[model samples]
Target: MSDAILSPDQTARALPYSALAQEIATLLQDPTVAVPPRIVQALQGGGSLFVMPAADAQVAITKLISFIPGNAERGLPTIQGDIVVFDVQTGQRVALLDGPTVTARRTAAVSLLAAQQLAPRRDGPMLIVGAGVQGRSHLEAFHQGLGVQEVWVASRSRASADALVAHAHSMGLQARRVDEPNAALADCPLVVSTTPAQQVVLTARPRSDAFVAAVGAFTPRMVEWSAEVCQHLARTGTLVVDTRDADHEAGDLLQAGLDVSTLPSLADVVGQTVAWQNAHRPADGPVFFKSCGWGGWDLAAARCLERTRAQQG
Candidate 1:
């Protein structure tokens, strides 16, 4: 029999941001789960394909996705593919999920998880950069996970920025379009940078309480923050990464010449209680959360899907 397939909407409905972030938090502490390095192949014209696989005792999953930065210009989804989930013991295919949706949601959930533990203050306006799929996902994740009430949208395309702003307003939050994202950094305590990393979009130094999550540039060649901005954060604030893989893949940190090996990762913080996290923060500077792609995060999505399926049945 063919494996079941879930459309993007169905898959999204299965993995709510709060639940997804909680799942990721759980997996971070589960040493039994195994996540090997993903294989990335370069495609022509600057695009790339990713093959990621992860497994626990009960379920296994492999995701095949391609990212083409030029798709935005052509009015196409930049990310495309599917994730195949399987039963570990039976070796039978369980289901397939829309890869782009999973990627966007899980990546944002990782940022949400970061914000929950790292943000000095939670209730405030948020700033979103890169008005694309990631931008939309981050907006929803923050709204759902952080109770954000207001937002600022910044992007290279005015139309795209305006559309995201409208979407935010539809969600009943105060929203605006900012041509320069850095200018609004002082007031927005939370910021998510989702640009394609072709160039630096945020240059100005953020306020002391800012919690900035930069998920745009996974490869070393791509970058969204200027060197000075990264250095300032590294010197004065706590620098955390989603995973240790960021030691090599985080363009902003690597380009800024910070030692990724010494940085604290999300896993490091996930083990602590929420109150402990809030109380133990550095309290000196902004918190910079660098997220490079990781297969373990995909595993968390699969686990959530499996749980959702079990609950429905």
Candidate 2:
């Protein structure tokens, strides 16, 4: 039987981010999962459409998301789409899932998972760059996953940033808006960048022992971390990627001219912890996880949401 279309609200309510994060970590370690590079089409006026697919022995999923930079001005989200899932054994359609919600929650949880592995501990204010959907979702993720006591929202738009802070306060978290991201970075032990800026937005060097997750600027044309920041990561920190294909999709890595082949994957960390650690760590520096996102995560999250909804009934 086909499931009803799941709205963003419903999806959010059903998503168990912490548990899902563990599942994602397990999936990452699983050699059987296959997630190819997303097929992107250049739309007119600098817009783009992405078709991402993932599958395994039990299930298959494909998500179609569109990016329209001007949507924010019109009071709309830039990332919008849906994920379609099918049963691998029967080849039957099973569900239609809210794409942005799934993408936002899973992306944040994945980042948090990586942070848990690398970060010494979560005990300070988190600096969230870009107060958009990803930013808000990540705030929730860090709050729930790490018990983050304080959060600082930094955005290009003062209004958006302030609004995010207000939302955080409503959730009983200590939150505020900061116009200067670099200054905010100085004090925060955990930092997440979720903007889609074409130019490097974060120029400040993070703390020596900080944990930074850069989740925006997926395309090679866009960048969140400055060249110097990337250089510092390459030199003094362990640079972890969601996938080695990030060598191609991650703008920060590509722009920095770093050798992706040499970078360690999250899978490596999951499977070979000691070796990965020995190879990637600098004597002293911030650990960085650059995620371009992948379809495998989409499929894993979809399964969890679908199961939760089924049990609810």
Output the lDDT of residue 98, model 1: 95
Candidate 2 residues 29-102, lDDT tens each?
A: 66678888789999998888999999876778999999888788889989899999888889888888888899
Tell me the spans in candidate 1 whose CA falls farther than 4 Å from its real position. Answer: 273-281
Per lDDT, the best of the predicted structures is: 1
What TM-score would every model get versus the actual structure? 0.96, 0.95
Q: Each candidate's root-mean-square deviation in Å?
A: 2.4, 1.6
> 1-313, model 1: which lDDT tens digit per residue?
2367999999999999999999999999998899888888999999999999999988899999999999988989889999999889889998999999999999999999999988997887899989999999999999999999899999999999999999999999999999988899988889999999998888999889999999999998899999999998877887888887888889998999988877778988887645335533565789989999798898899899888777888
User: Per-residue error at 166 for model 2, in Å?
Assistant: 0.7
